[model samples]
Target: MASGADPKFEAELRRGVVQLVALDYLETPRYGYDLVRLLGAAGFPVEEGTLYPILRRFEKQGILSSRWDTEGARPRKYYELSAEGRAQKNAMLGAWAQVRDATDEALKRSMEAGQVGSPDGAEEETTS
Candidate 1:
């Protein structure tokens, strides 16, 4: 929290993963609340405020479809990944894998090289 880089990167990473993880789980029909709990259990916490809007947008965009389950004590809107969503998720998965692999390689190179530059993005001096 103290480091500026930590918060920025964490926000970016979580924002990137939200759609991936949500679609992965929504491969089956699930209500939004159920999804929030499941995502939290999976170690990727998503607040309802943050998730509901995404779900609504995806629904409107036809990336996913939703139906109401009125048979239960309370009505719940269930969402499922659409065929288009499946294709989108596949593409996102492929892109994510590439990014992850690149990040891992960068970490490997960082470990081999030690720190490449200063924390503020300044290049370290080299002596000839």
Candidate 2:
């Protein structure tokens, strides 16, 4: 919570993993509170507020769809990843692979050069 620091670092990390988490849970319909509990139990570390917003954003992005089920004591909105969400998850997986491989290579080179490892590892790769 320092100035110039990313206040939502935790939220951003959760956001990055949301697609994968939602995909994993979409095997069965889940209500918002259930999703939050499951994600916490699974160690993704998200608050209910953060999870709900992300769910709504994903739905808006065409990555998910939902409906209310009134069979419970109160109506519950259930959500599932859309076809587009599945595709996006697949593509994100590929991008994750590329990033992982590139970081590993850069770390190896940095070790060879006696440079301490840093986050992202490949600052040079960020430009051109």
Candidate 3:
């Protein structure tokens, strides 16, 4: 009985926040396409539709600061995390750690019972 969806898959509720997440991943300012590819390599796999809007929104919200870089034939907007954004990312990371720990424990128990598909989910490859 195959439904349209894969039972092993799950959607990230963190939808529009990849820009903030990307900021934490970057050591310095990054332009739009660079940020997209970087996150994809890191396994977040952001689409341009999702990332570009978030970048603009974060810039508007003061969590990001941007400047025009004209080194190329055409200019591009480069984004860096503002002081407030860095502080917020730190706080979010702390909360995410707690969630991850709790989820890991639950998955461990479920795996022991053969209850869920992937015991470690996305964390498996990272672990070993």
Candidate 4:
């Protein structure tokens, strides 16, 4: 078994963060492949299956606007953030910061109390 954090938990974490990262990228217009390349280069390798559905959903929700470019050999659809998208992205970023800070504080408290890997870990659970 691989040691360290659970892969499933890590993937769930990544999935939550990807929305913010994708929205940040869409601040400027880009096509699907461009997003894949840029995100991959940035160490966030997103799959087409994952990315396209997000783009389409955002477009459908009016958070993103799309235009077609037929000037090239093949037509491509480009996506950009709409006004509402920018506002939503900002709100999401702020909420993310709060969550990150809270998690950090909780971890710090756990470490200080020497409860990080305690056998009775469930006793530390709290409903917020």
Compared with the true structure, all predictions reach lDDT values of: 0.88, 0.76, 0.74, 0.87
Give the local distance difference test score of model 2.
0.76
Query: Can you rank all candidates by TM-score, best first?
Result: 4, 1, 2, 3
Q: Candidate 4 lDDT, tens digit per residue, 1-128?
A: 23378978866787878888999999999999999999878767779998889889999999999999999998999999999999999999999999999999998887765654454575554557
Q: Give one digit per residue, the lDDT tens place, for model 1 in 1-128.
A: 23456876877778879889999999999999999999988867889999999999999989999999999999999999999999989999999999999999998877655565564445564667
For 19-106, candidate 2 gives per-residue lDDT tens digits of 5766668757898888888887786766787677778888899888899999989999999878898888788878878977999999
TM-score of each: 0.84, 0.71, 0.71, 0.84
Model 4, residue pairs in steric clash = none
Please give the distance, in angstroms, between residue 86's alpha carbon in candidate 1 and its true position after superposition. Answer: 0.2
The list of candidate 1 runs beyond 4 A from truth reads: 1-5, 115-128
Q: Which stretches of candidate 2 lie over 4 Å from their true place?
A: 1-14, 115-128
**Best prediction by TM-score:** 4
Model 1: residue 34 alpha-carbon error in angstroms: 0.2
Tell me the lDDT of candidate 1.
0.88
lDDT value for candidate 4?
Answer: 0.87
Worst 10 residues of 2 by lDDT: 119-128
Query: Candidate 3, TM-score vs. the true structure?
Result: 0.71
Q: Give the local distance difference test score of model 3.
A: 0.74
lDDT preference between candidates 1 and 3, better one: 1
